[model samples]
Target: MTLGFGEGRAFGYAGCNRYFSGYTLRGNRLDLGTPGSTKRYCEGEGGEVERAFLPLLAHPFILQREGEHMRLIASDGTRLEFEAAAMESRYP
Candidate 1:
């Protein structure tokens, strides 16, 4: 999955679908609005991952950054890890 955040908005590939939402960051706490996604249905694991990932955005998160790597930690402590995509392949 690839995510991009800028100007208080978030957009990313959620395994099967592309998702977009508004987000706010205040220190370590971050809040994301309900994500909107394309209506494509994916089968098997892709579908499962999309289902699971979208809801995680409903809760508050803690952002952890280390060099080019980042992790979004849910309130209950679930960690979603990501790395900066290469410049030539930034959008996915």
Candidate 2:
């Protein structure tokens, strides 16, 4: 997945769909506003990951970065890990 955050906006491709949301961050805590995304169901794991990912974005999560990796830690300790991807590489 690819994530971009700036100017109170968060947008990215969540495995299958592209999503945009409002966000606010203070220190280590981050709150995500309701996200809207394109409605395109992907086959197999892509669709399933999208379904699980959307709701996770609706709540508060912690952002941690280590080297080239980023982790989004949910309130319940569920962690979503991401790595920086080149813009030239397309998502499946």
TM-score of each: 0.88, 0.83
Q: What is the per-residue lDDT of model 1 for residues 34-65, given as tens digits with 9 covering 90 to 100?
A: 89988897999989999999999888899999
Error of 1 at 43 (Å): 0.7
Which model scores highest in lDDT?
Answer: 1
In model 1, residue pairs whose N, Cα or C atoms come closer than 3 Å (at least 3 residues apart or on different chains), thus clashing, are none
Q: What is the C-alpha lDDT of each candidate?
A: 0.84, 0.81
User: Which runs in model 1 stand beyond 4 Å of their true positions?
Assistant: 86-92
Candidate 2: C-alpha RMSD to true structure equals 3.3
Candidate 2, poorest ten consecutive residues by summed lDDT: 83-92
The clash number for model 1 is: 0
